[model samples]
Target chain A: MDYLEKEILVLGCGNILFGDDGFGSEVIQYLQKNYNVPSNVYVDDAGLSVRTILFNIVLSEKKPRKIIIVDAVDLGKPAGSTFHLDVDEMPEIKCDDFSMHQVPTSNLLKELKNFCKVDVKIIASQVQYIPEEVSLGLSNVMRDSIPSACEMILKEMSPL
Target chain B: MGKRIIIQPVSRIEGHAKVTIQLDDLGNVADTRVNVVELRGFEKFCIGRPVEELPRIVTSICGVCPWSHHLASAKANDAVFGVTIPPAGKKLRDLCNSIAYTEEHILHFFFLSGPDFVMGPDADYSVRNVIGIAQANPEIGKKVVRNRHLGTQMLDIISGKSIHPVTAVPGGFSKPLTQKERDKVLPMAEEVLEFAKFSIAFAKENIFPKYLDTVKVLGVFNSGFMGTVSEDGALNVYDGKLRLMKPDGSFTDFAYDSYTDFIAERVEEWSYLKFPYAKSWGEGFSMDVDNPKGIYRTNSLARINVADKMATPLAQKEFEEFRAKFGRPAQLTLLYHWARLIELLYNAEHAVELLNDPEITSRETRVPVTPRAARGVGCVEAPRGTLIHDYETDDKGLITNLNLIVGTTHNNAPINMSVNQAAKLLIKDGKYDQGILNRVEMAIRAYDPCLSCATHNLDGRLPVRIDIVDSEGILINTIQN
Candidate 1:
């Protein structure tokens, strides 16, 4: 489907090459392997390309109605805790980020939510241990949380 | 008292760009350092993995330029496995590189560095961005987005996936382009070529003229240039001999295998990034703009400056005009934008040219390969700069050592030099405004350095928060724009 045709996007946003940092995509993998998400809800592992995908949506003339982000986060909760976080609650991690595209700032998600009028939401799990280097796969704690995260994501998109 | 000022933008993803600028007692710029994250850990991570798997795994390091990594890794693997890919295989790789460059150069020009040139550098932060560009130039914005999407769509059709591509394997491209796929992609390449023409024309007429004054001064510095070029000195990003052009327009061409003899890294305090200088120049290292010793740049501006000519006609014409105007080895950093547009046109033309070749659709893309203990060095001109992936393997084909001198790493010192030059020129007597700071940001933006490629954070955009402090580190002024 064309990107605009999708009403909701469930984007798994993290690199799986890094240990527990792959939580978001791990959930997406679990969903792809296990669940049957409807066509209206587009799901994929965004990985490190999250910013570019989000930037495209913001620049796009027609945006999806909602963007659901699934990623690993450090909320200081239990290692495997999964929860829904509001965009406003996201730390000022937002900045004038510069990659090749040098996509501009506030936070991109916040921009989608506030400026673009898209319902942007996040489903995140506290990482057990994100390796300082490249160590593939999720730790048992983070790996164990994937099914619940997938379930939570499906439940959130239940209206769809 | 001298002051240490830190310009940091917080990002949880990959620790983003952290630039530290030191000020003398008079509040004049003393020094600047573009602090990027380390890649050594990731290098070590590749050690135990199978040599063949590296081409797939390395793409995970940077989302922004995965294709560049994928190709470089594949090339390195080919060198290790001692196999020369079939003609169709080489064409496929070249075609993909050109297409990816088309996508990258367009996005960097229209989205990343667009606003500063289009809206004027001093415009307010809110309206001086991508959304603002869309609002102001709706038609142009649409074209930019559409052309970029077309590039992605083409990559998707060529390779099964655009992001984290594994199509580029050790011996050759894993997949070949079918005639039907080539036919489908041809029109898109032609369309992007048209856009590339419009983009450069638009910039020359509207965007560049307004910023010419700023271009002359901001980030202005003299340094050597580095890039890849074909045998006859034509600009070739996919495969070529490495050229290191000195500040005086003189250059030395060398093979990638002997890159270590020409370039060496100065490990200053073992920071997140390594400072590589021209060892062959034998000037040690320095970022002093007035008398930079061994500093050299690698990116669009550098590529254009070093190359004798562009491979394609339209780009060659644009390149001639650029060289005629700026002279060879342009010192003005802002001209990177100008040089970038020229490359954009080159890639666009190159893509169309590649698509026209019959071999691009050939099925004999891959060749047989046998694993053996070997060391290989592969280099490509990534959109940002020269990307060198050096690797070694055991007899069993397991990786023993690997070092990736990514595009951004080559520009590490020059970025600092540009920011320092910008800071020195703009900030005076400890007084500065958001406009001044944005200009400072603009200098760094001109190179269009991929911070994600630098530090592995896809969203590693630099939201510069400059803090001015005294020698004792007492914060006096903070500018967060």
Candidate 2:
């Protein structure tokens, strides 16, 4: 990865209206407020449609050297447990669907990594729960892990 | 035993859905239902919240077309406050809607639905996607990517943010298009217009003609259509009364706020989505393909069918060409792709036209408003279909009651009917392959239904756990893959 290009992207992905699903977005807000982002790094909250960014990146000639996606997961770990996941580690997913939105995230990420030659990283926290209905806010465990999540990302963002 | 063929997690449209097809003893299709699994409970959750917040909150409903929800909700807020938005403000909203449509339609036509036509419907699944299109045609792929990026950038320049926009405020827009901003985006708008022109031409010459046979036969059905039109009956996506057209081409125009009077939603136990029918039609809603009662279609095909003519010259020409070939109320489901291209051209030209207007940069974009107890309904032609947002507010402007009819939800009945029809037409003798099932999916793709919610799971273990249950709700068989 070209650490000099500053072409690194840190994305926080999830829906803020879907309980613990908002953990990633909340972490992004925390990172923006507390951390001083370097010139080479661009941090954003891609929210529910991160697929748009990943899809564009895959199609475009110019691409970021590295990408770190922050999200919440329920991998049966204790709530708020943070860990790293490579693109290959993600579960297989369906084609990009509409139901007006496709979180075609996993598949798009795989494409970006294997074909686009980009270094992709996922820093996911164990979500307490994701609500089916429109509930807001993260669980206390997930919310408390925001700072730790940001730190983990910052570590990954270190000069390649 | 009658056979049930289930294609779970229908792919490449918006959110995921499932299609279950039933076959009778002779192996011909008996019935079919497309099951949509997630529910946002948007109305119940938003109740008691301040109405102004809806414009922002609704953006989270779907990331693909957040601008539609944002603007529609803002319009509803404007209605509740009873303020006439400034001309400049309305123009800004229209500008955003057109640009968003360009991005969305391009994504659908090239990447999602494009794979089927560009690569052939029976093409191997591995090479039928965005990558396939890019590898096959690199130049068009690059232009498509750059243009989509430009769309988001232009939105960010017009409003403060692009993804979850909060710029459309009650009574008017919060931001004004400065002269400098207008100059910056004008050429970008023209670039998109050039691509739009090329896109429709390419589809007509290369794509549509190749599939004319399939377009005629697959998923054909007779159904009414819905969309918005100006008082002059010209197609206007931003503002207009609702035009609900019958299968025979006769129609009724009703006020936006009076939607409840003409439209009624029917709930089915099997689907998370509701079937909205023409309550004003006097025939009760039914999914019968031979004679669908009160069932009407929305989205691209419906939008064009309901409109008398396109507002832009280029689109109007294409519209005339389309009508000459297919005739009015085109019942062929695949014609949706054709109709979608017309809207893309119209939106691109419309964007260029609006950017040229001097009033678009005027500073008086919004008016002040005080809260009062009132009912308001806002409607817009979302890329998916006609999106309607109705809100009833208390004296404090808190939402007391709310109902939302998303563009895709309007096609719920039509989708099931089309799936049933396609399954019946294609799967004779109960012989079906991945290609056959995917073709049935093509019927739903024409509508371009957006499910509006992400399918969540515990640590990516979705579509992995299978629970086999019997009619008595007993866990008789279990399969985990």
Clashes of each: 6, 17
Using Cα atoms, each model's DockQ against the true complex is: 0.43, 0.41
Tens digit per residue, CA lDDT, model 1, B1-481: 8877776752222236776778787877877777777643787778878899988888888888899999999999999898888989989888889999988888888777787777777787777777778899989888877888888889989998887788998889889999999999999999999999998999899888887888888899888999999999999999989999999989999999899999998777736788899999998898778999999999999999889998999999999999999998888998988999999999999999999998888889999888789998878889989999999998888889988898888887888888888989987876667777677778887877776765644243346567877878789877665
TM-score for all predictions? 0.95, 0.94
Candidate 2 Cα outliers beyond 4 Å, as residue runs:
A1-6, A91-106, B453-481
Q: Who wins the TM-score comparison?
A: 1
* Model 1 local distance difference test score: 0.82
Tens digits of per-residue lDDT for model 2, B1-481: 4566766566676776777776776777878888886565767999999999999898887877899999999999999999999999999999999999999999999888998998887887657667777889999899899889888888889996888888899989899999999999999999999999999999989999899999988888899999999998888888989999988899999999999898999989987778899999998988989988998998889888888899899999999999999888888999999999999999999999999999999999999989889999999999888999999999999999998888888888989998998998899985777688779989989888888633332222222122323334555443322
Chain A superposition TM-score per model: 0.90, 0.87
Q: What CAPRI class is candidate 1? A: acceptable
TM-score for candidate 2? 0.94
lDDT of 1 by residue, A14-91 (tens): 877778878877888889999988878888787888777777787788898888889887767999998998886654
